[model samples]
Target: MTVQINTDKNVEGHDSMNVYFTEELRTTLARFEDKITRIEVHLRDDNADKSGVEDKRCLIEARPENMQPVAVTNYADTTEKAFHGALDKIKKVLATTFEKQKP
Candidate 1:
């Protein structure tokens, strides 16, 4: 699956960052490889410089052929946490979506 990541205002665009993000996504959702056409991840810092509870926001969108895109968002103290949180939500959404499509 193709993966794209975007950071809002706070973070700079970098090849290293993209590679890391894509690698993490591939590792996390290896099982859905063939079914997913594309995955987009958006990360934003609620407070550019502040550090506190759940300030980072992560949104993940998964698009599968012939199906509506599945999307989820979560907030946490770090990108990893927010990502996993969103992942969990998307997993549930996809499960329900697939069930509805099954005969």
Candidate 2:
């Protein structure tokens, strides 16, 4: 599958990038890499100028065949946490969609 990652600013290293893509979503999803056509990830800092409890926001949009594009958004204190939250939402959505398509 094609993976597209969008961050709020420049990343320090590949470790951060990997965390956002692989480790953060490893357990929650099935064999999604092969089944999914494309994944669009949008990471942004909400309330960047102000201090808050949870200001990081991650939005992920997954497009697959014959079904509506699954979009999930999450907010947390850290980028990794937000990504995990969004991944969980996407996993549940995909599972339900696939189950419905099963004969």
Best by TM-score: 1
Model 2 scores a C-alpha lDDT of: 0.76
- Worst ten-residue run, lDDT, model 1? 9-18
* 40-61 per-residue lDDT for model 2 (tens digits): 7888887776767778888988
TM-scores across all candidates? 0.82, 0.80
Best-fitting candidate, scored by lDDT: 1
Candidate 1 error regions (>4 Å) = 12-16
In model 1, the Cα lDDT at residue 39 comes to 96
lDDT of 1 by residue, 1-103 (tens): 8899999887565888788778888887787787889999999889888887998899999998877888999999987788789878877777687778779
| Alpha-carbon deviation at 76 in model 2, angstroms | 0.5
lDDT agreement with native, every candidate: 0.84, 0.76
Compute the lDDT of residue 42 as modeled in candidate 2.
87
User: Looking at candidate 2, what is the lDDT of residue 12?
Assistant: 28
